[model samples]
Target: MNPFLLQTEVRLASKLIMPLKLQLRQLSLKRFRLQLRQLKQTLDCT
Candidate 1:
């Protein structure tokens, strides 16, 4: 395998992965916030 081709493949894979990682992080944060809100509501009710 050619070194240049391998390098390009790695760069492309990283470019694709960066946004996916960011989206996952954002989704997890949203879920965490939702959980905290639910917890607060339950505490208030109790």
Candidate 2:
């Protein structure tokens, strides 16, 4: 196995993983916001 090729593969995986992580974080944040809104509305109604 070539060291350079291995390094390149690792870099590519890292790049892909970063975006996936970011997307997961964004989705979690959005979900939290939606839940918060629902909770607030329920509280207001009560």
Candidate 3:
């Protein structure tokens, strides 16, 4: 295989992965916020 082709493929794969990584991070952050809200609600009730 050509080295240049391999490098390009890697670059493309990384480019594709970047957005997926960002989306996953955003999703986890949203989930954490929801959990924090629930914890606050439970604490308030107590």
Give the best candidate by TM-score. 1
Candidate 3 residue-wise lDDT, 2-39, digit = tens: 99999999999999999999999999999999999999
Worst 10-residue lDDT window, candidate 2:
15-24
How many clashes show up per model? 0, 0, 0
CA shift of 5, model 1, Å: 0.5
lDDT of 2: 0.99
Q: lDDT for every model? A: 1.00, 0.99, 1.00
lDDT of 2 by residue, 1-46 (tens): 9999999999999999999999999999999999999999999999
Show where candidate 3 strays beyond 4 Å.
none
Per-residue error (Å), model 1, residue 2: 0.5
RMSD of 1: 0.4
Residue 45 error, candidate 2, Å: 1.1
Q: What is the lDDT of residue 21 in candidate 3?
A: 100
Model 3 — which ten-residue stretch has the worst lDDT? 1-10
Task: Summarize candidate 1's per-residue lDDT along 1-46 as a digit string, tens digits.
Answer: 9999999999999999999999999999999999999999999999
Better of 2 and 3 by TM-score: 3
TM-score of each: 0.97, 0.82, 0.96
